[model samples]
Target: VSGNYAYVADYANGLVITDVTDPRNPQEVGHIDTAGHANGVYVSGNHAYIADWLNGLVIVDISDPSSPEKIGHFDTDGGTRGIYVSGDYAYVADTSNGLVIIDVSNPNSPEERGHIDTIYACGVYVSGNYAYIADERNGLVIADVSNPSSPEEVGHIDMGDKAWETFVSEGYAYVADQTNGLVIVDISDSENPEEVGHIDTYSALGVYVSGNYAYVANHVEGLAIIDVSNPSSPGEESYIDTDDLAQGVYVSEGYAYIADQTNGLVIVNVSNPSSPEEVGQIDTGDKACGVYVSGNYAYVADTSNGLVIIDVSNPNSPEERGHIDTIYACGVYVSGNYAYVADLGNGLVIIDVSDPSSPEEIGHFDTDGYAQEVYVSGNYAYIADWLNGLVIVDVSDPRDPKLAGHIDTDGWAHGVYVSGDYAYVADWLNGLVIVDVSDPNNPKLAYDMLWMTFYSVFGM
Candidate 1:
């Protein structure tokens, strides 16, 4: 509004002008009708270029701000949605015909100079004579709209394949891309996340990073360990085969703990990673789906028998010390004096494990659907409820655990890992979903800023 006047492109009213010299209490003093809907406008000197959808560019002279005069017009190949004026020409973003350059040097007769065909040209801005196009489906595309007639592609940003399960460690993030396998992304610069490495595996369900290695749970293939010391190129050292389905994994001390559905807790001596052999095993009465090791006890979520606690202090001969019965227990997370069990049918079951010999139920939070996986952080217990999605329970009052919040995910929320203020969820068919849980009572899901706190990756 350098000319003390502002020209607005209105869909209903072709063009509307308002005097801003008075700053406040200024009213619309000029109006003009175009053949088509006025979508966008750009003012330069005394000329106001309007991108009239369907009708192309409609040039108006605002020399006299009170009453605008339509001096020139140009019909484009397709509907124009956005426009930018520079020098003697006006660049219009023609919906499907790409960038259409209209010469407005002669106010009386504006003609189309040239055009570059682009798909779904929704938005465009000219800077340094180059046009930045907001291409739908495709990431930001910078084209040399400088030469509108022969606009050449100057640069482009590539958005890598989508990831479902993500594990962030140190400066890198291990992502599980079902079809593409494991993708290593460099998140040192959160502003610009780039894929540095990737490994092809068959259906990576869960991912965990420990020391210089990355542990990936490969459904049928078992545990696939990769040397991630070099973030750019992760080399697969070896793979350990298990009896049944390997759904989740956790690396602690020098051993790799695997949750083998039918085999219960499968402990592999990862000290010698290249050729890992099963050193110890313990059955949980039923299908053991999830496991967590804290101190001398190994908490197992046995789908049929519920929470099974085993003494892993003796790595060679691990024996069951205690057990807590629950309905269809699928996941277990061991915390101080308590064991959080994700009961698929019942909901979140809290058990008191002050004594390793006997465990008793302390509290419970009845959820909506199948609670498949559980993770404990602070006074809150996050449960991945299969159909109902994420269910957050406040466990500060163990005897009376209350529902803190709940978020319905796009897909079946089978697994979750809480880190910082966001929950990195492994949504079954919906890929990786980052939910903002800074406010436990009111959780949000959208990309913004990230703040660190504790380092915890509890896999499904």
Candidate 2:
């Protein structure tokens, strides 16, 4: 809880509000019923946006945290899931319909701006004047959305397997390519995106790039580090074998924190890029899937155990500080003093990690599908769902998360990452997926790369 307001979308329960002036204690303020299942939420000033599954979009005025009133809505022809907001437009991931852009200048009356049909449209982000869409099997799609009402497809690149999510930075796009591992693309030219390099982890699900290193969460291979100093020729630098299946990874300082399936939380020292070593580890009993590090502590998604906090002041000896037992935790990311956990079947769980030794669950967002991975940037949390694809939620109000926008990539989304204005995803068998999340609400696909073969003759 950062300020005086908070919003949450409680799947079948609807949207809920709370006052979080006191980080330790959060009080529920209001609630609003939705026609369909609520999955994601976003709060902008006095308005709260929601991604209502079968019902499409739902808008509400949250000026009065205790009494939110519905203002307007727009129903997409297909299943409404993920969403993002930028400028005066809202980007939506409508199941099989690809990407849908809407004019939200009039909060109460959102009008369809434009759309690009693709495979499974999951998550989106807007950067500059372009939209990046995570198109599951199809890969990353970059669209020129200077004119929201007439968005145009500009470029695309498909990674071998299903692309669950993506993150773009410094003219490069890092993607989570399910079984194909992590892929890096050169998006310097949005209209002619190309695959500069890639690191295959066999079954990697999520990825994050910080500085010259890229951290990947390999389901069974554990955490992998790749040196991307040369974008056109990126190569695997090191590997931290957690033993347990790794799902999500986050880097802070010189350490890489990983979410391990059964080994719980595993911390690696990446200061030596060539010799990345496991510094600390903890077993949560439950399946540890996602992780994020902040200050001296590390937050982990302990699957059925909810959220677990560990002290990382001594990277070689991380001690369990606190934990919150919730439904099914999957992904986790930390910002400020709060740790956001993606609770698969339970939705989103927000906890106050101000006191690492005694963390507490402050709030939650119960989306319809089973949330897989999560990425936090600015004020939003992009969630990848196995069934529904990608769902974006506003965590400005840690306790009460609101739906901003969403995209439904047709495949089974496993992981997500945000960079610049793009979101990358790792879809099971679909390959690498990219989405333009610059607009936040309305994201579009740019490019895709299905399969690339490289052969070499040994003893000719």
Candidate 3:
């Protein structure tokens, strides 16, 4: 919200600009439907920057509230969640790319100046020369943004629970800690910020500090006002119940590792699926696209961070051991000593994970289309190439993978799984496409299930 016009990110509806000059009754002035899911928005000068969830940063010209126009955009290639515009730059809390600093000096051509990867950057607030990131699970991460080209993490504090949003005022940082409520931190010393006070609230996601009161937005409990006159003993002033605006569940050995998009990697104890409990989790510092558990290690295909290897030997405390950067790793398949990754732009990347601590990309096969999913069977690897359809690669020799066969499907191929002699491909709009891989050299389309909508095709 800026001045008399309120810029709202209305999800699928895009950005909605309303005139709130009359606090009693606001009127919808103008709106622009964005290409992606509009999650967070920030208004600066005559422009309003929107953090469009998959499509990246969208810049809109709000010079005229009656007819807001989109001038330019910058694709962060990740799920952009929160945004904060200051000076000539716009800071974005990108789920997969972390805190992205964009030079919005030219609203018509916003350029990415720099970025720093965090666990799950849900929200961000820039104060002075530091950028405070509300990193879920990883807690609050403070980075020195004086130099946007290469921001550095100078201080960090684990909020115990998920840190969703933060508002800094004076010398204190008030954080909305999910499940744990409002936590106040003393930031007089940026190098070593300490938690000075806290008040529990149910699923707190947003917060705003003004004068002596802090307004908090909670998930289950709605909006709660707290008196922060004394930072040490803050008390809840009043509350009003309101309907608040609000992924992959991978289960292995009584433990479920979820590649939660904006929430990062969440591990739950699903020993009893009926009544599961969250044990521990680690933010992959990017979008946790896919996870493959091989023995004690969990290989996560973090979209922007590539393949992130986590030591899940202890489900209560999963830790990221190593990571190998890739263009955009969305899916991963581990077989024996190797981890095969289906990198979107870079195609297939074969990494040697014999050493979990230091995985190295030994070979790669650039496919004709965008690779989204992969399945390894015996000496062959089946990849779901978006437009180019199903691509078959011979992994008989992991070090030097060769393309064996490829068959274009009716629609976009999103996922693939091989079983017996057939490779099941999940074609986006065209439904299921079964390809006969009995002959790896000359693959044939066995059948096409032209009905159900699918994203991933897997065989049991």
Model 1 pairs in collision: 164-431, 164-432
Each prediction's TM-score versus the true structure:
0.60, 0.58, 0.49
**lDDT (Cα, 0-100) at 220 in candidate 2:** 75
Model 3, 1-460: lDDT tens digits are: 5677778899999999988676446799999999999999988788889999998999998999999899999999679999888899999999867889999888899998998989889888776788878776576688999999999999776545544445556666666666568777664554345668989887665565656776665654545668899998999877644322212334467765666554566665644433456677787887775777879988988887889999999988989899998888888889999999999857899999999999999999989678988889999999998767899999999989999998978556877767667776766544456678899889997776433233554333
Clashing pairs in 3: none
Per-residue lDDT of model 1, residues 1-460, tens digit only: 4455667889868988987565435688889988799999888888888889998888888888777888888988888898887777788888888777777789689877777767767557665657765554453456786676677777654323323456778766687555467777675554445668988887666677888888887767888888889988888989988888776677888887787888888888888778888888887788876778888778888887888898989778889999877877877888899998888757889999999899999898878677877888899998888657688899998889999999876445676777777676655433345677888888776432121111113542
lDDT of 3: 0.76
Cα error of candidate 3 at position 372, Å: 0.4
Worst 10 residues of 2 by lDDT: 451-460
Which wins on lDDT, candidate 2 or candidate 3? 3
Per-residue C-alpha lDDT of model 2 across residues 1-460, encoded as one tens digit per residue: 1146556778998888877565346688788898888887866777777888889989888877777798989998877677777888888877688889988999979999899887877666666577777676676677888988888988776645454445567777676666466667776766466777866666766677888877777777777788888877778887767787776677788888887777777888888878888878887768776666778887777766778888889988888888877777776777788877777766777888888878888878866667777778889988877556678898888888888887876445666667667666555433445678888777676543333211000000
